[model samples]
Target: MSLRYTFINVLVSIALLSSCSTPKGITYMQGMFEEMPQEIIQQSRITVQPDDKLSIVVSSKDPELAEVFNLAVARHQVGQSITNNNNMQQTALFTVSPSGFINYPVIGEIYIAGLNRQEVAQLIQKELISQNLLKDPVVTVEFMNTTVSVLGDVSHPGEYPIDRDDLNVIQAISKAGDLNITGLRENVLVVRKKDEKNIAYRLDLTNAQSLFQSPAFYLRQNDIVYVEPNNMKKRQSTVNGNTVQTPSLWISIISLLTTISVLVFK
Candidate 1:
């Protein structure tokens, strides 16, 4: 081949190779977008825990009769009054005892720990009917302190309320603010309490199947979800006190090599 033709051919090959190569910037690695698992959706069940405040309201056709049973009776009052002791009057704040029982008005003590809100409500309704306190009681139980914390690489980092009983890890992350581009998908941390012990779970959102089998997929009350930033973010900020910048360094090297190749070829 002629010198000019060979030179042109070489330049074209270089350009094609460079084009196929990843750009010299933050590259989003594959295996990040995962589908919702069916089994996870089916088996995501969380039970109540001690020290969790629950709001129980029972209503009947006869409002007066319902109110009578719902009244704050002396014998059923176990915890110090939030109004008198803490100077706060929150009706839903019923602290579950270490024994898993709650001292509800008129109903006395009912064991509710390890039960879901719906389960507790149904149990209360059954109790009211069995005791003949009301003809048919409409009981509603709500968690007052169903809060989850999301920190690290989130738009809003802090505590958020979990309105529903079945909140998955991804939903919790969205609530805190969806993960940033630099957020690490393989090392998302879930800090939760299980069997009275604090447990930390590392979840990999990159794999589509990992969340399906993960026990930490279901978020519990007072659980903390943390999304650590990728190496790019670490170099940009003083996050976690580590000054490592691997992503940035890789991008710089790649960009320099690309620029040098284009100039030499031209």
Candidate 2:
């Protein structure tokens, strides 16, 4: 064969070989087909925190008394009204005071901060019995406005409702449509509010072991998950169906082109 034809044949073979090679660090290609560890499943519980709006319901032999408690709990729902009168106003959901108490009808001032919905319901049930409000009161609690914020490198970024108490980092990410390819999988950051202070935790999803040891693996109410972009994605943003690239993005583009050329030629 002529040298020119031989070079083309070799290039095509190299290209085909390179295309078949599995990318490094990909979970599917790595031999990890077993089920996740038991410890990971056990460590997925998330406790409730302060400033979390909850719906507390109480029932009793006397529905009237239960209705009173329900009404009291409903009063705690906070928000504002905007009318065509052109007036705009905003209001808080639950107003837990610095003393950790909220004013409830008949129950008076009750401490609710730092308590989960179930605990709050139990407390209210005890209060009703002690106050002679009802006999054998049954209580139920639900999070009325519990939400967590998802940001950075997700299909949809915004606050999502906390429907269940067992929501974890992976489920939260899934709720926001999972991380984009450009997202940093090994270094996701979760910001939370604890003890009237802001705290942050780093998570590594790439390692199966990290699923058990990482504190951020379980999501808390008002928790913020931020998926930083990979190095190449940080410098580029797509708008109007066009890619806007910075110096770093251009470098990555050139590197990719060079890789394609080398694999084809070799």
Candidate 3:
């Protein structure tokens, strides 16, 4: 073969090899068959914690009786008494104390931390009935400030509110626009704070059973899901933090050189 033909062949071979190299572990929940066992599906529930804000509302057949148990926002001027009208009173957010208690009206200090919304509501309902406060009372509880933080290698890394009672890790990741292709899905880290101690769990998105069985699969309030960058991304960051040294850049350079050589040889 001539010198020009050999040069072209070499450039073509390099480009082919670079193009054929595919990234592994990019697909999530690998080996997830169509017929998944019922035991593998885990139920996730959000539990209340200290520093959490809750919105509790009490309702009964008699509106006046239930109003005494519900918390209301009251505004007062310097010269006026703290007068609150039923129409003007809005449901106020109750902040859980550091000791995991909320000083609810009529009920006094109630320990709600470590309990889910349904449990909290039930506790309040039972309190009203047992204390003879309301014959037919209904209590509803909602988490006002529960959120999860997603960071690193995600399209949108920020705090996403836990709107529902069961916000799992997969849903949280989806809220952040899913992980980028350069993210290391095989080793995603989930950091959680339980009992005032920070606990970390590693989850592999490529494995279906492992992800479902991990405790981190069910994300809690203030949970942090961090997606580390893959090896190629780390190398790109180390090398001037640009695409100049990437395989695509080399392919472009080789294509340009080949075009010039063909013109000269012709």
TM-score of each: 0.71, 0.67, 0.80
| Structural RMSD, model 1 | 7.3
lDDT of 3 at 29: 91
lDDT, candidate 1, residue 6?
61
lDDT against the true structure, each candidate: 0.74, 0.68, 0.87
Answer with 1 or 3, whichever has the higher TM-score. 3
Candidate 2 has a TM-score of 0.67
Best-to-worst order by TM-score is 3, 1, 2
Quote the lDDT for 243 in model 1: 32
**Candidate with more favorable, higher TM-score: 1 or 2:** 1
Among the numbered candidates, top lDDT falls to 3
lDDT of 1 by residue, 115-174 (tens): 888899899899888988889899877888788899998888889888787888888888
| Candidate 2: tens digits of C-alpha lDDT, residues 10-57 | 655655575477745324112235565556545444444545565556
Q: Tally clashing residue pairs in candidate 3.
A: 0
Give the TM-score comparing model 1 with the true structure, all chains together: 0.71
The residue-by-residue lDDT of candidate 3 on 1-266, one tens digit each, is 39899899988897788778886788999878855556654557888888998999999889998988777676654466665555656788999999999998877999988899999999999988999989998999989999999999999999999988878888899999999999999999999998879999999998887888788888899999999997778877565675765677887899899999888887
